[model samples]
Target chain A: MKAIVVERGENTPSLIETPVPEPADGEALVRTLRVGIDGTDFEVLNGNHGGFPAGDDHQIIGHEAVGVVEDPNGTGLENGQLVVPTVRRPPEGSNEYFERGEPDMAPPGTYLERGIDGAHGFMSEYFTSPEEYLVTIPDEFAETGILVEPMSNTVKALEHAFASRSMFDWSPETALVLGNGPLGLLTLAMLDQTVERSYCLGRRDRPDPTIDIIDELGATYVDSRETPVSEIADVHEPVDFVYEATGYAKHAFETVEALAPNGVGVLLGIPEDWTFDIDGGRLHREIVLENKVILGSVNSHLRHFESAKESLARVPDWFTDDIITDVFSPINAEQALSSGNNRIKTVIEFDTR
Target chain B: MKAIVVERGENTPSLIETPVPEPADGEALVRTLRVGIDGTDFEVLNGNHGGFPAGDDHQIIGHEAVGVVEDPNGTGLENGQLVVPTVRRPPEGSNEYFERGEPDMAPPGTYLERGIDGAHGFMSEYFTSPEEYLVTIPDEFAETGILVEPMSNTVKALEHAFASRSMFDWSPETALVLGNGPLGLLTLAMLDQTVERSYCLGRRDRPDPTIDIIDELGATYVDSRETPVSEIADVHEPVDFVYEATGYAKHAFETVEALAPNGVGVLLGIPEDWTFDIDGGRLHREIVLENKVILGSVNSHLRHFESAKESLARVPDWFTDDIITDVFSPINAEQALSSGNNRIKTVIEFDTR
Candidate 1:
């Protein structure tokens, strides 16, 4: 079997040959169909974000993945069944989070991501996973199942943002998406279902595909160079909900001033260490006096994956076509890993069948 | 009738002669019994927080008040009934907050606070309020009814805090109260009923009466000067719920590190402008990875006042006696306002019955 791996002290992916893994009890053998490459992959490649597999110099790195079962190995999974694997396997110990089937709520240093942390990823020809970690999807998702993992995170973030306002009559009329990245576009598409008005803020110039998609969805796109998040209320109306996908740190505070009364902001970005001065009192007052809430969400639970399946089914086919701009074969995986920000979404194809 | 008023450019409260108000068709004339003095009153006197009434050079300064109805004016309220008036009144013209009975959630400029902003407060010997603004209380609350106004705010804060976590099975075991002033003490007293183990953080040293009362309640007293909030998890177990009552801006950011996984912090303090540098990335990462929530809560609605009446009834007599350390007559109201931090709670009595 062939796999793409990032060795210690090396910040680039390389082709490596390894033997195919045999599925043990309660495990199923899967042949990768497609694997998504994201910003986390860049972080892992640069050795800046996640950890390497224990006792191994390299880790196979791809979390947003789709595969077809090759061997059931006595599990309930069927051979050739289409499946998507969820991220965040429990660490080697007694973890109440995985015990309760909620690894999404687990604290950091307690759980490991399949591709980004202690476990080897599915950016290979073959992989083995516990049957419980795989979610069976319909045949229609075979081409787009690689998107399920990222969409699931947005599902959980929006669910919690609404849940935080469940105690009041919070009918949000307008929403703002702080980043025009892949995650922000998906969040904007989801909010379009409920929010009457929506806007997406990005630093991109015109003629960008993401901006075109924002316009196609009937959402206003404000170039962040012309209008920052703090001045959003002055340039446009204050939003009732803010979806922050840019891990810039300052947006977390700026979201407070940009929200209308009784609004909520859902934060999904995680940034590196940076120090900055902020008007802490104004941010505190807006939240306290206006009855606002800021919720921090990361990863996704199994239920969110199920909801994401329905949410993805609702997205028009043109969006999927417009968002995924690059698809690379395993032989050219390095090109997919080093793609610039202009690329909307990148994927590595292991097998078509 | 005599009233305490704050004149323009003078931060001191002075006695003034005024006519007893006449109850209109929808209004009820109330004779003030006792008015509680809090930090908000001081802010109004300093002219740094709230605004003076429109077209007036002076503002009456008391909001935490309990009184007896002298005239019902054909309203549902009964004459001689014990009543507590809510602080916020809808601004002139149509307002949605007052219409929905949720003035607490109103935006900052949409409403006015009696005594603190744009309206004459209950500090006068006689005051008029629309019948809908008064909450009827039991006879037992006559002595302690003044506490209802401040306690109502905590009720609203805790209610929203728990509501934010309702989607999960959140059973908070340990809690932290960030201040030992009147609001923090009341919050700790309320939390003592449900939280198993609790701690109160204050700068007070030994032999302080607030510390003694904290001991009486069986909660650990932490000297914040020695143990900062950032080191709470190392010094004591990380808390599941944090009640912030200190208006110091830094405590808001420090709360992110003090919370346990999936925990929440409810901020009730309102601070002034202060610029400070913080490691924003660490704060953002902790919230996202741990599923932590920060809720900002301010004034209370009418329902909170009703719940507060019940919460007040639950307090033992010794607590009520020990907490209210100072009681002053109107002629000595100046002394009441300038009392030192050693005083646990202060009140100015206008009438005993």
Candidate 2:
């Protein structure tokens, strides 16, 4: 088996030959199909994100991947079934925080590419994960299974935004999405069905096809480089909801300012540093007094995964092949990652069968 | 009528003779009885708090006061009834955010001594207020009516804490109140029924009677000047809820660190500066993994006033006249303001009848 592994913190990932992972009891050996690159992957490479365990060395790194069940160790998953594995894997013999049906609250352990000394990742021909971590992908969704991770994250953000407050009837009067990256566009797409109007802000101005898709979904596009986000409300009435996906601290402050009174701001992007200089006086006077909410959403929950699956059930009809800008073979992983091809989403294709 | 007036920003308040106010439609003329001093009053006196509408020279300088209704114009208030007036009054002919039943959401207006040109305050022999602003006080709660303002503010803080998240069931947990001022002690008293254990932190030695009351309520006291709060937590477990009443930015940071996982840090005390450096790394980690909450709480809602009235109704039975401290006549208002007698709560008893 061959996989992409990071030698150390702040180092480029390299493809190397590795032994095929074996399925233990209650675990599955997944033969890789596609792996996706995300901001979390970048953080893992830089040793910035807290998702990984301590004392890092050479390790497998990809978490967002779709694979086939090569072996299920009698855990009920049949061979040849497509699945997505959970990124977090709590250490064995840890407290019940992990075993008590809440893996998110569990202490850090051997996360793929994050921990687990010399572990092989899904980018390889074969990888192993706990059977509980695998979610079966429907046959119709296999082609675009790489999107499940990012879409599930968007679902989690929406769930957190709605859960923070009382269950009020949702009226998407207006929404302002504060980025045009892959995650940001997906956020706009997810919100397209809910909000009456949507605005997309991005850096590029070449009328990217993604922006065209957003426009086709009936959202207005504003090039952030040319227009100020603070003036968004002035241009398009006050935004009722703001989705901040820029992962930039300045955009976080500006998004809060753009939201209308009693609006909700959902923070999904994880920046390198957590320092954000918000206008506390303005936030206290306007955001709080106006009944607005600023909430954070990190990773996907089980329910969000289910919701994302349901949301993605329609992707086949809506997303054209061009939406997936680039696809690489497992051998060309470095070129796939470093290519500045205005790629919205790229995938690493593997053939383990 | 005689009143205390500030001519301009940073001007010293002076006793001045003014004409008695007459009740307008839906308004009332109240014979001022008791006035309570607040930190906001200090800010207005120094002309440092921005957003105050009153100019330096002609504004009356009090907000928290109890009075007798001399006349009511069809607002269902009977003459001679005791009432506490709401300091916030919206501008004329404007249906502001507050007028829509969101008092805290209301824009800046003539707020007692902070705004309102040439408006006589409760510091005067007589003053006028809207009928809606008057909160009727039961006859039994008259002696402690002046404390209602401060107590109501505490109630608002409690409300904000509860409103932020349903992360914890407060009844079975421990709470830490940082600061031993009147607000802090009052907050302890309020939480006595809600939390199982209370910890009071302060600098005072030779324990005061309030400390005795705290002890009587089964609360542990920590002298912060002599002992670090982190050490206290080691002895009696981390607090599930922390009320920061020290009015210092550094204390806010410390209180946040002292909170247990899934804890709520309520910032009830207001610091002068809006800009302050907090460790975003710590806050983000706490917020993300531990599910901790930090929220600001100020002023009071109508519900808080009602709760305060209900709670203070039993004060006379639970407390003694000694806790009432000194009662100075309105003529000695300046002396009362300057006394700094370590009084828990001092009231100006007006004789206007």
Please list the residue runs of candidate 1 whose C-alpha ends up more than 4 Å from where it truly belongs after superposition. Answer: none
Write candidate 2's Cα lDDT for A1-353 as tens digits. 88887666445678888678677888888888888887666655665444333454566777778888888778889988989876655555545544554454332242223222234346677888887778888976666777787788778667655544432233558888888777877777788778888998987766577787777778888887677887787776778788878766556556656877556777665554465454454544454334455555555545556677787775545663656778888788778767465687787888734
List native contact recovery per candidate, as a fraction of 1: 0.77, 0.11
Residue-by-residue lDDT tens digits, candidate 2, B1-353: 87775556444566778789777888888888877666556665676444333343366767778888888767789988988876555555645444554454342342222232234456777777777677899865556777787788777666655654442223328899988776777778778778888899887776576677667768888888776665666766778788878765556556546777546676665554466544455444444444445555545656678788877764445553534567887667676666475576667777744
Clashing residue pairs for model 2? A60-A113, B6-B56, B6-B57, B7-B56, B7-B57, B8-B56, B8-B57, B9-B56, B54-B115
Best by DockQ: 1
Q: Mind giving the per-residue lDDT tens digits that candidate 1 earns over A1-353?
A: 99999988899999899899899899999999999888888888998646888888899989999999999999999999999999889899849889888888888889989989888999999999999889889988887899899999999988888888876678999999999988898888888888899999999888888999999999999888999999999999999999989998888888988899889998888887888999888788778878889889989889999999999898999988888888999999888899676688898998685
Colliding pairs, model 1: none
